[model samples]
Target: MNAPRTPLLEMRGIDKAFGGVPALRQSRLCVGRGEVHALIGQNGAGKSTLIKILTGAYARDAGTIVFDGKGVDFKVPIAAQRAGLSTIYQELNLVPQRSVAENIFLGREPTRFGLIDWRHVEVESARILAGFGMSVDVSRPLRSCNTATQQMTAIARAVSMRAKLVIMDEPTSSLDETEVSTLFGVIRKLKADGVSVVFVSHRLDELYAVCDRITVMRDGQTVAEREMAGFPKLDLVAAMLGKELSVLQGTRRAGPDASMPEVLGVQHLRSGTRVKDASVTVRRGEIVGLGGLLGSGRTELARAVFGADAVDAGQIRIKGKLVKLDEPADAIARGVAFLSEDRKTEGIIADLSIRENLCLVLSPRLARLGIVDNRKQHEITEEFIRKLGIRCAGPDQPIRELSGGNQQKVLLARWLAAGIDLLLLDEPTRGIDVGAKAEILELIRGLADSQGLSVLIIASELEELVAASDRVAVLRDGHTVAELTGDDINESAVMAAMANGTANAAAPAQAGIQEVAHG
Candidate 1:
């Protein structure tokens, strides 16, 4: 037998902790040269922490990292890059106003006679992009190109660095189908050139399409590792969830009753290019989920309904009465609440105390004669903190000091304090630990069941949508394509509707449910 090939990169016995809580424990990963390795887990499953350790963004408490047959410690990201490893994060870090050529050669531009060579930069950038089957003008500003082109330019920058290993984190999260195909082609080219790749994505199909080996993480540990060819999708999901397939299959609950009063309705909703002619309904005490790919108008529809975005054309009915929401104040005045996807910027007021953040939306109602009631605010904050199980030092603790899950809870409490009838949540469980996710999901179910709250939720996670939604509205290219309910509200069926833009007729639907035709 031939001699065994050495691994391109190896990480073993990794341990990381934050605030006395372990994020990773004895996590291990080994990647071979010229192979596409997939790292998969739910939010806060240590994937990000591990990658940060590898890239020197976060120092590991305990671990041994071996790369290119040598032991090395990278003190910073630049050090990692200089050591022949590069990482492309979900958010592209390139300057938007700079030309593509300038972005590619940002810090390391070629010089001629003590000056930067613009022509050489453009020629080299074009050559690098052409290698990836991209022909965009390198002289144009980066922001002039679409999201896909900008992402490709980021990859080109990484490749041009002569990196032996490239780590891509959620690279396709914002790309369309065709754009994703283009990215896959580039990955194949990189593999052929003996470059190792570490791919991280929430999309299972993309992992199945491009990865050679797979590693699954759960609860801050390496749970499973296997070849991608024969691995079952259900098995992978189960591994990530730390549950058996049978347990997951049995967790599908029944949908809510259709006879309930229609609490919210949208007819022919159109907002900009992303949301076009979309329609949906939420019944009293029911949860409706919006399901689609990243650019498929789910967020746009939510924003339109919440009046965060201007509606070009649409009719919104609240409790059988037509209403026009010209601004967010109108929606809030009508007892509507929205929880944005980006919790850090849009949801929480980090500088304020937890009590202050919780009382923000209800400030007007809680005040008397232009004066604030500090005692009443404290009482209300304490009540919500106990009810929502928000872990914090006290009501006076800054919201920024709390964990992601606790911060989300405070935001939820803000709306609850306002006594809203309908809540719009976008990726409520995103970027939180699994235990926290379960708690939040349970709280949502309780709100619908006990408090008669109608909710419209937008979630990228298919399982969350299927489990929590009484009916799921599928959107494609900004149009509501189908509405799945009962037995039809499943992972396979939803994936079919998203991929093909058509509902599966064979799947059984609940009574009184109708398909939403695209306009």
Candidate 2:
């Protein structure tokens, strides 16, 4: 037999922890040279941890990393980059104020004898981007470009380094269909050039389309690793969840009480291509979870219902009364509150104090004849601070100083204190830890039960959604295709509904679902 070929990179028996708490236990990865490898897992499956260790962003507590036929321990990220390893992050790490050419060849530009060659930089950058089907003015500021262009620029920078392996984290999260296709083309080109790629994404279609092999992670461990050819998507999902679908049976619960009044309803809600057509209904004191894959328009539906985005054509009914929502103020006046998925950008004001942020919505009501009512504000802040169990030094502290979990609590308090009838929460428990996620979901559930707050939420975690939601509405290709109830609220059913883009034959969406037919 011939000698075995050495892999491009390998991390065996890796272990890591944060503050003595284990984050990775024997996590491992192996990527072959010139192969496109996919690393996939849920929100907290230690995928990021493993990648960080490989990149030298974090020190591995225990493990041997063999890269390019040498055992190495990278101390800093730059050190890893110099060793023919590069990373392209989801949010992008390039400076928007700089030119595209400057960003692509930021530090290592094509210089001409003790002087910067601006023309060469621009021409070379444009030439490289043309390979990816991107035609743009390279000298222009990066901010002028769209998100997809910015993302591609980041990838171009990685490729220009002549790296042996590239780690792409959620690279397609912001790209459109055409842009994603272009990205796949570039990846293929790299593979043909003998470069390896570690593709990390939650989208199954992209993984199955491009990746040669797969490694599934669950709870800080590598649960499965195999070739991608015949692996079924459903089986992959089950593996990622660490659930044996054949053995586990989901429990059925009673449906919502029909006597309860309808809180919110959307009929044929449409907002551009993001939300083609969506129809959903939420009753008082009920939590309805929105389920869909990436680009499924779940967030768009939530935004349109809350009046944050302009609805091109649709009808919204609150408490059986039709209302026109021209702006968020109109929705707020109608007792509707929205907690955006991006809390740092849309929800919270960095410089504002906790008390100020909490009382921002109720500020107008707390005012008297253009004169502020400071006393009532103070009392309301104190009461909510204690009642919501918000962990902070004091109510006057900056909201940014607290942990992610605490910041979420403050945002929740802001909405709850408004006495809103409907709460449109998009990914409320995101970017927080396991304990905090449980705490936030439990809090929402408690409020729904005790105060009769109707909630419509979108969660990436299927288990959490199944546990917390009274009903789950499945959206496919920007349309509300099915609604799961009682017995069908489990993960498998949700996945099937999302994939097949229809309701189970046994139970379909009540009505108005068949009106907006999908082509």
Candidate 3:
């Protein structure tokens, strides 16, 4: 037999830690030349950490990396890019204010007589985009185009760099089905051109459609590696969740009780372009989840309900009475609270102390004679800090100093302190550790069960929604297409609704639960 083929990229015995908290432990990955590989895991499973190390964003405490049969170390992101490696993050990193051609050729514009060659830059950028079947004006600002076009532009920049290895993180999160197909075609072309790609996404079908192999990570370790062909989807989910297949195949939570009072009623809700028509109801002591792809109006509906977005036409009922929600203050006064998806920007006041952030919503009610009651604020903060099990130095600690999970808990406490009757959570458990996710889910369930609070949760993770929700509403093209309940809430059923606008009745049971695909 001939000597074993050397991998184009090999990472072995990698170890990383943050403030004595280990993020990766002996994680190993090997990618063959020109192959499309997938890296998958839960929110805090060391996936981002590992990618950061590879791209030189973070220094690994210990590891060995071999690229193209040569031992190499990248000291910075630019150094990695110089070494023929490129990365496209989940969030588009291009400058929106810059022109498409300028963004593509940024920092490397051709110079003539020590001056930039604008004509060459525009021509080159247009040529590159055209190669990807994009025909937008190269001189226009990147933000002028739609999200799909911007995404393709980002990819075009990476491809223009002549990179041998490209890494994509949640690249399709903002793309529609047609745009996703276009992106896949580009990936196939990249593979054909002998460029290796490392794909990361939560969507399973996208992986099976494009990737040749997959590596699963759990709890900071590489759990399994297998070829994409014949690999079971349920097995992949179970591995990421760190649970057995049998456990996942067990019974789901029961549906909502009809006898409970309606806590919120939204009819014909329309907001902006994303939410054209949405109708939903949440009974007291029930968790209703909103499920759909990106731009499916899930977040828009939540914002409209919370009065953050202007409703063009709709009727909202709170406690069986018609209510006008013209602003967030209106919603809050009516015992409604909203936890925005972007916690860092929308949820928390990073510079403020935990006590301050928690008491922000309650400050109006807690004030006396225009002078805030500091003593009362402290008491409320201390109670929630203890009740939520938030790990922090003290109530006076800066919110920015805590971990993602702890910061999220602090945001939740902000709403809970107001004693709201209804909670609107958008991507509540996102960007946090798995342990923290379980704790937050449990806490939400406990509040609904004991305090009789109704929750409307919007999550991109179908399995998470199915597990935590009593009923799931699937939205497509700004419409509530289906509502899954009872035995119909499962990954397959949700995926079917999302993909075909209806669930397939004949899909086999991969994890014991049977699913139906209709509204």
Candidate 4:
């Protein structure tokens, strides 16, 4: 007789709502021992809501949760943690100012004679980190180390707590290639030790490379579940997009018009530790791409151009006129808009309605007699909601309640409505699913083509940038090392530029070059 299979964690018919609005509807997932399972969906697709419910950050209205073969319901995060579940969010929730040992052993520290034992804490912390092949000084402040080291520390803390299931949300977003490999090695070690893991990320390549199984979510429900070997990356993308695989392959188009005039110019720019000697130009009716590995200065370059970061030395000209954008307001005044990389902390106003979020940037222009015009605001919000196909119940819906992709569209609409001359986008499609990503890319292309808009896009996915950009600017250690276009574009060339800042050959970027229709 075949051995009976048993799930270590199983959640069935999970239902959750916020203020009478349904966030998750009948969502279901299962995890087995020693397997790395990935949960994926677009923002607002209920991935976070579902995880929060599982971790006891939010109580589910209806559902069944069985962990380690017993029915369970947790009232708080601590309760869930105590039951052998641990979650590491995208944002490092660790205390940066505190020592590594302190952050690792937070809340529950070793006690001797009713007082915390500092020496035991450090000793245990060092031993835990060492298991992950790390030997850093545990006494140092967590902020002193880079993101990779911080990530390792977080993982060590989770494992130290005897967690049975470790849920890592976008754990590799800020990690470099080497760091990612190291993390994968640690994951393998955990798997060997019989600890299950739930990996969540927008990077599909990483998912296929590491996860043993995949679960796709859409509109707050689990749509498909398949073993890793049985699924293709493109197929998984189609499932997340809620579209047939054949349709996605059929719709392929290049970027903006080549004949448009230059709208924004950057020359020899430098900002702080990162962002060095970089130069880029964006033409009206074109989408220029900034491509590089993590920490290669993609976000830094965007920040410098948008004046979010102070540029030590550089020249910026808008429409052939010099402008000193020392602050974000100055950049906006110059008709420049920036969509930040991190959406939670940098983009949305959690408490505002969809209308307010959409009109936040264009308030002054939409105002009259020192009074806000509600009708005009409604019209603007409705137009964008229809135009971008944002799936919200109404314009009055809370901005925080909308899905990630819809929120991004609202941000894009904010800039588009402001009559801006230049748009700076940083990882604009970071956490969104396949379908939304395609729609956003198409929207960008159409805007640049039909509206004569100028856009600078920073994206980590090589294929995405190559597919949608007029030119790819490769950065290495805060400097612009290479810019590839017609006859100099491909994965090999981009990677070559990224690793060494120079390559022997470059392939022509024929696909992204704008078509010319001469009379």
> How well is each residue in 105-155 modelled by candidate 2, as lDDT tens digits?
999977799899999888989988998878989988999998878887887
lDDT of each: 0.84, 0.83, 0.83, 0.81
Residue pair clashes in candidate 3:
none
Q: Can you write out model 3's per-residue Cα lDDT over 212-296, one digit (the tens) per residue?
A: 8888887788888888766666556556655553333213456457899999998888788677778999999999989876556
lDDT of 4 by residue, 262-282 (tens): 788888887875666788988
Which candidate, 1 or 3, has the higher lDDT?
1
lDDT of 1 by residue, 1-519 (tens): 111156899898999999999999999888989989998886678999999999899999998999999998899999999989989999899999999999999999999999999999999999999999989899999999999999988888888899999999988766766787888889999999999999997656677778889888887999988888666655565576554433331144454677889889999988875787799999999999898765678888988888889999989998888988889999999989999999999988889999899999888887899888989999999999999999999999999999999999999999988999999999999989989988898899888888999999888777788888888899866788799877777776665565445566333222112121122
Error of 2 at 321 (Å): 5.0
**Residue 288 shift from truth in candidate 1, angstroms:** 5.0
| Least accurate 10 contiguous residues by lDDT in model 1 | 508-517
Q: Please give the lDDT score at residue 150 for candidate 4.
A: 95
Query: In model 3, what is the error at residue 395, expressed in angstroms?
Result: 9.5
Give per-model TM-scores: 0.73, 0.76, 0.73, 0.63
RMSD (CA, Å), candidate 1 to true, equals: 6.6
Best-fitting candidate, scored by lDDT: 1
Error of 4 at 461 (Å): 17
State the TM-score for model 2. Answer: 0.76
Model 4 poorest 10 in a row by lDDT: 510-519
